[model samples]
Target: MEPGARAVPATLHTLRKNIDSIPQGVQSVVEQFSVPRQQIISDLNNVSHSIGFTIHSLLKEQVYSVLEAIQGRAQDLQNSLHHLQILHKTVRTLTHFQDELGLALRDRKESTVSLLDSPHCTSCARALGKAQSLEPGADYSRVPSVEQVLKTLSGLPKANFPDLIDQGNSTFNSMPDLAVAKMAQVVQDLKDEVNKVSKKVQSIADSFPVSDYTQPLNDALMQAENKSRPYLQEVKHYEKYRWIVGIVLCSVVLLVVACNLLGLSLGACGLAMREDPSDYESRGEAGAKFLLVGVGFSFLFSWLLILLVFATFLVGGNVQTLVCKNWANQEIYKFIDTPGNLPPSTNLTQLLNLKRTLNLTSAYQECKKGAGLWDVLQLRDAYDLEDHLHLSQYTRDFQKRLDNFNLHFEEIHFLDGAGRRDLETFRQSGIDQLDYPMFQAEMQNPVVRTSLEDLARDLEGLRKIQRNITIAGRLANESQALWKIQNATVLTQEALVVKLNESVQFLSAMAPHLQLLLKQTMAEIALIETMLPVQAQRLLRHEIGCFTRKELGYFSQYLNWVRRTLTEDVASCQPLATALDNGRVILCDRIAEPWLYCLRGDLSLPHPPRYSSQAIGRGLRHLQDSDSR
Candidate 1:
């Protein structure tokens, strides 16, 4: 009977019509496929080009039909559910309004009764009595009658009396509890109708088997899995390939070693023959020819061994290229491009061409740009490279840059307890707050000044040593030339020996200067250490001075270790050179091994000596004296 209830059936009818329309649209789409497959076959026969077009059209139509059917069904279900929900909400609102109306009526009635029983009403009645008692001229008869008084007391206007009564009666008749109970009955009826419609919808939905649709999704997933599995296996295979390449590289290295050893033995034999060719002549001419043949065979075998080693490297390069290509094709390359494996790009080429047009020294400038003060500091540990060659140049450049930036070394602050303790007690620290004035004074000190002067002098010495090494290299080449001439009987053995001795003399002269430079460097280090605090020193101990007691101890130990290592290295080099001087060729080679190997193997090894713990402890004890004072 309510307006909201009246709209529910019409809404339900519309929803049902929409639901039914979905199946009708689907049936129309399905009926369209009635054009036989034979038609497609006949079209292909008439024009082969039309076959693709026909198949595409047919497949598209089927896919669109399925999509439309699913969409329509989903929309219908949504509409039906929404309609039902709205109906339920409307009923609930009406029930709530009815309850509010009943409460308002009860409240109004109770207020009226309370007002009539109040003292204010009694006072008003007393005033009416006083008006009635007035003299005849006062017109006491003008007072309202009891019926009018009762009407006023009722708090309702005369014209509204009937309407109020009707309203109260209607409200009583439509009690919220009763309305709610009636609404519940109507809701049950509506639910029964909805259930019937739901059954019909369910029956329609059941007509389409889910398995038919799920099968296609499963098939797609299976195909994707099949495609990815081979890539995964390739990754595993590439890992094995890497190991194989490593093994091959190791074998090549061994072969190179073997070849070098063989070559050295053959060269030694050649040298012996040249030294005593007359001794060989004392034997029969046939024996001399046999010796020559043996020497030739040795040279041939050495050449073949070298060629084999070279081939191994070429093969290794090829394998590396293949592996790199395979890596690029893998899924991993989608995330990261391996270094040296990038594809060529026109944009990159264009950029490079533009740089060239600008006259840019691209590679050199890039390297210079990357080189910083830290890089120079790192070079100090690189013994394999001639670090001293660039040391002063890099230092001056860095200092100039720092000056341009208006930057100077600030005092180092330690954040730990040990640092605070060391500072408070005047203990020797690693990177203590720099006393700028003291540093300036020390730099001006004759000893310190002389050390720096000597450093410059030492650098010149190093340059001289470098020049000698260059001369030695040239002489070695000349010696080789002279040896070959002697082998050809163009030069005598004595002349060859004289040239070799000259080269050796150059190397020998260069050695002492290098040793002197090393000694001067050690002396400078000592001066720096002496300038530092007596007890656990800073400065020269670590490249970066120790700031805390713990850091100081670490630096001290590191410096000591470096000092000992350098001493041992220099000491070891002595015997190596001596053995070379003694003509023990094997010993000379052995001596070169330690120096070369150490340089190559531990390229980044810290060269600075470390401070010992005992030194730090002693420093701490000395600082305690200061605290006591």
Candidate 2:
């Protein structure tokens, strides 16, 4: 994280404080150092009365090159670690997914009984054949029960429900198989890459004189894994029995269906073939025996069947009513999470090895609300996660190594002692000691006593005046002599003014520095000699600070991200809740509803129509009496 903005200079300030902010701070320092370095270089040439001098920053070319190489190596290490981290996390995800996939596959295979194994299918096939044998004309309607059955069969959906489910399972299994194959290759490659990156990181860590800063981060990762191991193991243990329970329940339902189907098939077949009611060898007699046998079996097993269904209904219904519905409304958490409401062992905080209680209501609500894991779990109650991100113990050795590096400047002497003394003496000379404003005022006046151009003009005028020929000629000669003198005086005065201007400008430029240059020069020399090592030490420490801060900030961000994703996204209990709801639907809707509907149909089936000989005799006697009348 960034240092507070007010603590740092405005130039170093960042709008957001995080791992990335470190670079801005370093850039600010680099810019600050560059200004002074450039100033010193430019001003070195301007040192008065000095020659054959060179000046540069204490940071030499070789040192910069070495720093650059170190930085590159560190970056390489960071990149390797980043790749390794991604691969490791991916491997963990794939491993968890693979386990879940295998469990699902096993459960599907176990819970799904073959269509041949279901007696309902066999009985239905037999009944369908019998129905087909009946005449497709008026005879079909003679048996009203059969007519209704045919109508119902015709109305049923064309698709086989079991076959559709099997097809769906096949489609589902095929994709996972291919995906798993590709994922296997991908996981192997990722594992190999993780190893390679790990070795590379180790090599880089070894190259550093510091203790490895990555150790703490690695330990943190391991700690998280260790913490989750127990929970995963518990799930695995529970999964072992899940399919067994499903298969047992399915078998119970199938046994009952088989008995019912056998009885119905025998009774229906016998009734169709029966003709003579009094014949002992008649199929009707055999059918009546079968019906009684079926009744006896039903008497023996029906209670057991009812008991199973009732048990399931009681447990499942209550769970749906009391637990699942309340869970949906988020009310169950409050009830269960009350202190001492449930046993201590049932508390998730106890399960997770936390010292303090994490309110179930709060945890569930936060997860549902999509809060970050660190906030949801309140892991800070156990340990300070941010504290582990700091790399002071690791980076101190690196700082020491940098400090030990020889960064002393070679003794720089722009001038010998005598030369420096002479320069000082020149600075003290009366040249710049003059009253400059007075000199400037005095020098403003023209050097000539009169205007030369005006004198020349006057001479020309005198020459032009009309007079005796000899006197005019004499005046012209005198005017020419005066003009020549004026021109020479103008040139001489202009040359003198140019030289004086140069001298005055130089004096004015030097005047302010003249008072303090010697003391400053001496002080600068002394400071360079005395403070170069100390400044270098401070620079190393500052660079170390920046490096560690950036690294630690990055680690802290990573940890926070991992925590957030683990609790809020990856390890959500929503999936478990959803699975429970799905199981309820499968038990109640898919299994129980169909079974109960079949039972209703069986109970509603009509008994065969009875015909008595006595009724036939009475009808015959009545007909005889009618014929006699």
Candidate 3:
């Protein structure tokens, strides 16, 4: 029906040519028959165009649009047809990689740290997941059966399974196993610095112009501490069905095979009862070959239809994995694969005696593996609360407070240093009234100017901190920690905290000298205290930045790893998406496309072009002849 509608415009164009081509004899004969009409041919041409336009517009809206939509859907289904195969390849790769890792971890568990149990393993898993575009727990439900994957493997050019396993092994071996020790060392270092800083701050407090400055400092602390703090916000962790993924893959193979072959098993049992397989071995190899051939020929004729069935499978599978399609980002992420079971931690201490197991966290269903980066990039929200913690916004404000305090504390000492030199110079000038060169040199000195400029530059560094900071950073709740560090907010906050802490101990040691300056700079001290605690929620916000960076230490290590292994990692992950894509190209060159869907939505054999099939047949014969030689 739609084809006929499309034909209207072409028919009208043909009619126009026909009217123009009429010979003079035919025109005069037609003129006598239509003598009453003026320019009959032109009138007929106009009518034909009008009919063509109406048919064209009607079909454009009612027919072509609907067909286009249907075609689009068919294209999507065709592309996604090989989704199972992709999952299959992934299952094989991950299974191989996981087994190797698990074994290597077991070997190490007896000696030192178990890679299987460490948070660092979680970090590695996170990176591997992103690099491969698979969210372990989130994507488990989409994993195909071991059988399906094995089928795909049979057709694949052998994957670099050894290389993948070696990479996994190397990655784990390269990982720093003594994370606890490192954390302990970091904590100890922070403690030493804190203690040293506290003593200096306390000494300054001792002779801190008690009557004039001490009261103002206390008032500032009080004001800052009294400020209200925001509630601590945490990410809502999704239930990870990761552990079931491997189990589901194995179970699929079993269930599918079991359901299909139960009758075969029963028939085999009946045959065994009649005669054991020992009877067949009693005969010669020739007798056995004869028996196998008879069975093959019988099954061949019985299931001759399966050839076309398998051909359809080939066509369908190849279409789904078309090389031009972006299945890596699209189809790979579409379905949720079945989850896998997580093995019990080798490092975890199990109680020998217990009435019931103690559950420490509601995240029992959570997979041990880390989430991937794909989820973070795919969210629709500009700044979803789910993506970040409350501490993100609070960190920078805390750093600002620290900066203000440091500036005031250091400024007082700096001014005192400059003042002492100035006072001594004045006394010397009085003693040596004839020293004109010394006085002239003093006029040329830029001591105060340099000091003021340094202060401004340091203050400007603090100013630039917030300007570079962004909202996206503070919220890397469940993100790929390695990638999340790129956020300006995270970097800026970290920089500010480190900078503020750098001069803390040195500035604190100037208590005795600061006594004179304290009275002079009391307002500077007062202003810092008042602003620091109030804007930063007193101490909590600053501590949040400190705590966050401690974890960032782990993220940094992972980023270093990715940099080193990026090429290898890309090579490792590329095979699964590309494995089956070549199926179509190979088929188009070697196999014949015999069937197609007709316009009427029914299956039909395609009409061959003139001598096309004969040429293809000849190509196949010539290829066979060459192979035989």
TM-score on alpha carbons, each prediction = 0.17, 0.35, 0.15
The local lDDT score (0 to 100) that residue 367 gets in candidate 2 is 44
Runs off by more than 4 Å, candidate 3 = 1-36, 39-41, 113-629
Per-candidate clashes come to 15, 0, 18
Per-residue lDDT value at 70 in model 3: 29
Query: For residues 1-629, could you state the per-residue lDDT of candidate 2 as single tens digits?
Result: 01111122211111112112223332332233233333333332232111101112333332333333323322332332343233234333333433443343233223222211234332223222222221211111111121222222222223233343344334323432432342344334333433343333233213321112223323443554455455556655766675786566456445545544554565466445435333323433344444444445555655765775667567656666676567556687688767787887777655433225456666555545654334544355544544432334323443343334332323332234443454344344443445555545544654333443554454345445534444445435544544554454335444544554454555456556655654555555455445544654455445434543543454344345434443355333343233334444544444444445555463332222232446435544543453344
> In terms of TM-score, how similar is model 2 to the real structure?
0.35
lDDT of 1 by residue, 161-264 (tens): 23333443343333333323433443343334333433332332234222232244335445544564555466567768758864664454444444444544
The 0-to-1 C-alpha lDDT of every candidate, in the order given, reads: 0.32, 0.40, 0.30
Q: RMSD per prediction, one decimal? A: 64.0, 52.0, 57.6
Ten contiguous residues with the weakest lDDT in model 2? 135-144
**Whose TM-score is greatest here?**
2
